[model samples]
Target: MNRLRANDWLFWGSVLACYLLQLMPLPQALLPLKPWWLALVLMYWILEAPDYVSLGRAFVLGLVGDVLAGELLGEQALRLCVACFILMRFRARLRFFPMWQQALAALALLANDRIVLFAIRAVSGEAAVPASYWLAPLTGMIAWPWVFLLLDDARARARVRES
Candidate 1:
């Protein structure tokens, strides 16, 4: 019971941290390069603790993110739901892959996220995004290993403390 409680806090705390990171400001020149921090963190949780992170949870998180970022209300929610669905579908195989392989998978997932975002914007008749807008997923791919390791370490420490 204590372990479960610890895990819950760790999960939600990491998610909150990701939201902060996502909302943090960057120089205008670097804005397009900002990684999809929330997506990356949520992916870790979905893969590591499936029961704790579901499609509905992803949707809620994304909705919160959209409101926080001032994007279209359901944009992030839809993107997150799609990413969550894909991750959950392949969670079994992804869970056991080597970290390098997992990072590659992260790239694919993030790229798919970018595509979803593009489709959403296009349908909404938004202005064409600059080419640099696509760079975020690459940054996200590079950051995946570190994000995974950091969260994994934090989770381990949380369990150890409870033990």
Candidate 2:
């Protein structure tokens, strides 16, 4: 029970951290390179602990992210729901893949996220995004292994402490 509680704390703490990262300011040159931190973090959770992350939760998180980033009210929510749905649908296969394979899958997911965002903006009459807008998913792909390892290590430590 204690271990479960600790895991809960860790999950929320990581979510908070991802939100902070999303809100962090960056130079104009690097802004487009910023990966979707919340999406990546939520993907990790959805893949590792499906019971704890659902489509509704993803929608809520994306709504919060939309407010934080000052995007359209439902834009992030829609994007996140789509991403979560895909992840949940393929969780079984994704969970069993090697780390490198998982990272590739992450790349595909992030790219799909970009497509969703594009559709949302298009429907909303937003101006065309620059080529750089696509770079974040590549960066996310690069970061996936590190993010997975870091979170896995943290979870392991929490379990160890409980033991």
Candidate 3:
């Protein structure tokens, strides 16, 4: 309802901030450590606001990510749609998983997403990927718990405000 709508806005707004963080200029040495913020944010919404983020919304957001990052066309959109689809399909079990398990699952999801990107790059005959491509997901995994806790706290506050 209205409360959920308000919360959804908060979620999307935070996701936007994450994208900005992702795009912030940084030295090459630190780039691999940049967590996949958009994926984490989207996964949270997919878990916490399933009714708010659907396949269509995921697709659109992914398209924007693709354009923003200047990646191959449709690569991110497809990966995002697939990730969101899996998250939506398994959300019931995902929601009940312990925080450690949830972080593990998020790591797997991020790794899979990266693999998909690699596959797309290979298919497109892009340059060889460095071993560093694996680093982002690890960083993302490490960041998942923190991101989840922060978002959960934000959502709780939003819920309280609504009530």
Judged by lDDT relative to the true structure, which candidate is superior, 1 or 3?
1
Ranked by TM-score, top first: 2, 1, 3
Which runs of model 3 end up more than 4 angstroms from their true locations?
none
If scored against the real structure, what TM-score would every candidate get? 0.96, 0.97, 0.93
lDDT of 1 at 77: 95
Query: What is the Å distance of residue 122 in model 1 from its true position?
Result: 0.7
- Candidate 2 has which clashing residue pairs, if any? none
Tens-digit lDDT string for candidate 2 (76-100): 8998899899999999999999999
lDDT of residue 29 for candidate 2: 96
- Candidate 3 displacement at residue 43 in angstroms: 0.9
Q: All candidates' lDDT scores? A: 0.90, 0.89, 0.86
What's the best-to-worst order under lDDT? Answer: 1, 2, 3
* lDDT (tens digit, per residue) of candidate 3 on 76-150: 789989889889888999999999999999889999988888888888998598898888888888899888888
RMSD of each: 1.0, 0.9, 1.4
lDDT of 2 at 21: 93
Residue 23 of model 2: what lDDT?
A: 85
**Candidate 2 structure, TM-score to reference:** 0.97
